[model samples]
Every structure is written in structure tokens, then in C-alpha cells.
Target: MNSEKQKLSVLIITLNEEQHIKSLLDDIDFADEIIVVDSCSTDKTVSIVESFKNVKLIRHRFVDYTSQRNFALDQAKNSWILFIDADERLTPELKSEIVTAINSENVASAYFIYRIFMFKNSRLKFSGWQTDKIFRLFDKSKCRYNEERTVHEKLIVNGPIASLKHKIIHFSYSSYEDYKSKMYHYGILKANEKLAKGIKPSFLLQLLHPLYTLLYQFIIRFGFLDGRKGVIICYLNAYSVYIRYKELRTITSSKI
Candidate 1:
């Protein structure tokens, strides 16, 4: 009867995430190895990471989310990998569950972890964030991020998948301005991804898609149930869609 615990490696990709790095590092201290692939952040992020003797920091050039994550995957030495974001925190229940799952004899290739989205101090219950989940923990040898996606990267798991009970606390936005900037950045990345896949943008798409998104999120998804926060989130979601098409049009038009 062999009884050896599985070694876990934690990977985090960061860029000027000084505010969340330290706390996140503290939370994931149980890992056998911790790797932080930074995009040359011009902040105290690197220094804060350096304070953790257990963390291995690698500065890589920013290409896209998928590439950055894949780069981090290559750097991991352990069989089990937990890819966590700087702004996300794993609760004690989730951490314990992860430890138990990896140590079990019949472990899945990957696990889907749900997230509780937070806007500053408030936790938004709606705004299309009710069913947010991500593949964060998995076997390093069996999973890799999809190269095609640049913004919202998806994992390509080779084997069986399972879902965890507890959820990760995602402190998504620090401020309104910060959230808007991130949405715009994500919109640009998504537009580039669509362009790569030979997808063209239309004026009607730029106009109507945003309206549809606003209605779908605010009304259909019950975003309005959350009140003021819901309104802001739904509007931003619509704005992101508008920016995506608007950017796609700009890029295509420039080539002509």
C-alpha cells in the first residue's frame, strides 16, 4: 500500500499586480513549487514576489493570455498544477478539497472551480456571473491552455474532468475605472482573436450586439436584481461587446 501525497505546483501570470500578489502567495503556500511568470511589470509586483523564497519568478514578454499560461505550464515541475490568478483567492474549504482530491487514488485529469465575483467590497450575485467557473487545477501532463483564445483562455484537457464544491473568491475589479480599462483590454484581445480566425465585423453587429448583450445580462440574466452594481456590470459587458466589434472594424478597415 503506497501512500504518497501528490506534489502540486502553483502557477500565476502577473503584470503590475502588486496589490494582490502578496496575499495570493500567502494563500497558496501549500504547493510544492510556485511559479510566477511576469510580463515585466513596472511595479512592486516583482519585489513582492521576490520576498517569497519559495516562489520562482520568470519574466516573459506579453503575447496573449493563452501563451502566457502555456509558458507557465512549461515551467512547472510538479505533476499537479493549480493555475491561479493574482486577484483570485482560494478559500480554506476549496484548498482542503484540492489537497484531498490530488492525494486520492482516483483523481480526475482536471477540476473546474467556480468563482464568486466581487466588485470592490460588494459581491455581485447576478450580472451573468452566477455560473462563472474555470479549469484551474489539473495534471500538468494532461492539460494545456487553448492557443486560439487570447482573452478568455480555455483549457484543453486530455482526460476526465471533475468539478469542485467550494468556489474561489475572485476580486474582479478594484474600481469602476479599473474594471472599464480591463473590459476594453479584453475587448481588444477578443477582436484580435476573431480577426485571426478570419471573422469579419459588420456595422450592424457593432450596433445591435451591444444592445442584445445589455438586455440579455440585465433582464434575462436577472442582473437588475443586484440593483446599482448590476446596472454598471451589464453596461460594461455591453460596452465590451461594442468595443470588440468596433476594434475589429478598425483593424480590417486599416488594411484596405
Candidate 2:
């Protein structure tokens, strides 16, 4: 271990995430600063965060994911920012690797960290999650999330990008109902994003696209290998697609 610690700012965006906030804060205590941009959480999230004297919590209104993330970026005092989610966890090995990476002589502007997705305490190995990676650790001076994306935000890095060796453990959903609600929320956001781009919905696509998604995830992506849980995940994923177009149609129809 290095005797000197790096000047790093850990950023997190939260909304009613009382269940996982404490553990996440404890894990990243090695950082010099921790900034949490909360979206007016009604739960004990704000109170729990206040317990940590080192954490700086800012209450911001909920908009899109991109805007929330970009707003978090602006509040960071350090140049190096590790933007992690409330549902994600970092291992001891990964913590060491992160320190080494930033302290290296030839460090990249941004680094991609892979994750192991979990559904209801079960590790999901398939359903298009095998290659799940996100740009969590990066230089704030050279990177910012794309504003156009409302759901799955994309990070635009001005310099070189690299990948980390260790992976994060992502507890994606607490229950089936929770997962379904999250998917539906993502679907609605996606629909609004498409509408903003002047893209209209089609009835045929709403019907066929979901079926294709089911088949592609379960059969092509080997989701069947995971057994019963895989089937549920695949179905819900397809359902989210259906809900997206359904909501889009509902929004478009109200104009008349």
C-alpha cells in the first residue's frame, strides 16, 4: 500500500436509497472527499448521509439521469472523480487497483469498470450482462456525461480511456416488483428521449420488438443457462420495451 493517498472525490446520485447508502459510504471512505447529489429522497437517505461528517449532501430536484450526473460533476472539488451508483459495491482488490491506477505515471483520463449483476441475491451470468461496464472513475476536467441521453447516460471523455481489472458487484434489484417498477421507469424515460428527437412510435414495432428482445436474450444470449431467474429477467426486459412504445403512443395520441 502507498503511504500517500490520492486526492479523489467520490460522487453518487441518490433517490430513496437508504438501504445501500451506508455501506457504499463506508467502502469509499478512503477517498479525500465524498459528494452525494440527492433528488429529494423522502426516506432516511438524507439522515443517513448526514451521519457521515465527511460526506457533503446536496438536495437537487429530479430531472433526467444525465442532468443529475452532470450536476454532480460540477460540485466535485477534486479533478479525479469516481462516480458510483448506490447499488454498486467495490471489493478490496478493486480499491487497491484504483489507488494504483490513479497514482501511476501514465494514467488514462478515464477508466471503465465492469460489474457482476445480481437479481434478488442471485448472480446473473447472462441476459446480455456478461460485458456490462461503465465509466465510473475518470478525470472531471476531461469528461462529462452526454446531455441528450435521459436514461442510459453516456460519458464523453476528451482523453484516452482504459479498463480496470477488478469488477463491481451490482445488486440491481431487491425484488421482482422492484425490478419491474425500475424497468417501467426506464421505459418511460426512454420514450420521452425518443420523442424529444422527433421519433414516433409504430404499432408493429411495439409488437415485434419485444418478442425479438425475449428471443435474443433467452436464446441467443444464453439466458436459459441461468434457469428460472433468467426467464423472468428476459420476460421483464421485453416487457419494458413494450411499455416504452405503449407510453409513447399514449403521449403522442393526447396531442390530438
Candidate 3:
């Protein structure tokens, strides 16, 4: 079958992301089906999603990313699913590649797309983010999320995977405050995940991890190449690690 003849579903999960919702939805109009699984957004997000045609909106309670995405995958009608975040936009080349890839014979169970991270509207080429990639596009039957995870969940692919050349743009940090707020909360989530798994807190992770993260990103990863933006990102990354362990300490303490 030709690329245009093959159908695919695009799935996205959103909360109160009114400021960051429309761009991603507008970019993936090429998909045969666009499904938005929202966790009860009390903002203009729902209205904006309602404006798009060929888009089906679903309201589900907020769970971890893995379970929520898996639920969204189940709601998808097509054999192929493209999972995207609210801050992510599909480039034209990637959209074309995805359409072509889905229709190809002997295709693998999934595909990996490299991500370009944008911080405060500036694209950061260094800061150890250049290697960022995710396996998001896949055949629904052969792939599902690892629901046991509480954060940074990995997809489970039952078969071989392929790769695409073009990149997906991730406007992950709209502002410095936004980045800090999100990362701190992410720290809490990660800490809780570790605690639930019976992983005890460690002084090495709590005390040394943050410093190691800073040096690794700034020096080893050549984060200085991005100049001021790189320095900012590097510091924030280290801070996030610090917060994670600190939160873990608190969780462990509360239990005792």
C-alpha cells in the first residue's frame, strides 16, 4: 500500500497546557486520526482541541505517563500509533517520514526519532541534549508502555525497531520558572517511584549526584558550546538530580 493509503493514529496527553497545546496539534494534521487524551484540563486546552477536525478528544483521570499513554493507545483506532507530548511539534520531514514508514512492508515494530530541545525559546545544540531521542512511533500491537514506571517510562517493543532521520522539536521549557517548577515536581515523582521499589536513599546519590551531573554536562558533554543557555541548562539538570534525592530522603523518613 502507498503511504497515503495506510492509516495511523496520533495520541497526546495534556493537562492544563493551554499556552502550549495548539502548536503540536496543528502540526500533525497529516495523521489519519488525532486523539487527545486529556486529564481534565480546566483551561482553554479543551476548547482548542475541539477546534480541530478529525481529532477525537478523550477525558481520563491523570495517571503516570506510562499508564495514561497506554490507555490512549488502546483508544486509538489505527494499527500504528504516534505518541507526542503537548510541547512537542512534528517537523514536516518527520511527518512525511512517519507516513511513509507506516506503509512500508517488512517494517519493524517501532521507530526512533531524535529530539531537539528548546529552552526558553532558544534551541540548545549542546548541554548533553543532542543525543536525546525517543521510540514513540510504533505498531500498537507490538508495543506498549512499561506501566510499572512512575516517570521517564520506556516503551516495550516486542520486535525490532527502525530509525528516522528528521527530528522532532521539543519546546520543553518555555521559561526559566516553568523549567524549575516542572523539574522540581519531576524530582518528587522520581523519588516516590524509587521509594515504592524499596530502594533505600543513599548519601552518594543525595550529595554527590548533583555535582557529578553539573560537571558531566558542562565539561564532558561540551555544554559550554551553547554558551549562556548551555550553562543554565547544565545547572538546572544538576539541581533536578539534587532535588530528586532530597525528596527521596523525605519520603523514607516519613515512612519511619
Residues 85-118 of candidate 1: C-alpha lDDT, one tens digit per residue: 9999999999999999898787899999999999
Q: Give Cα distance to truth, residue 23, candidate 2, Å.
A: 1.2
Q: How high is the lDDT of residue 18 in model 3?
A: 92
Q: Write the per-residue lDDT of candidate 2 for residues 1-256, one digit (tens) a residue.
A: 2346568999999999999999999899889899999999999999999999999999999899999999999998988899899999999999999988988877899999999999878799998788899999998999989988998999999998999999999998688898899999999998999889888989999999999999999999999998998898999999899998999999999976
Against the hidden true structure, what lDDT does model 2 obtain?
0.92
TM-score, candidate 1, is 0.98
TM for every model, in the order presented, reads: 0.98, 0.96, 0.95
TM-score of 2: 0.96
Give the runs in model 2 whose Cα sits over 4 Å from its true position: 1-5
Better of 1 and 3 by lDDT: 1
**Which digits, one per residue and each the tens of the lDDT, describe model 3 over residues 8-55?**
889899998898788787788788889999999999999999998778
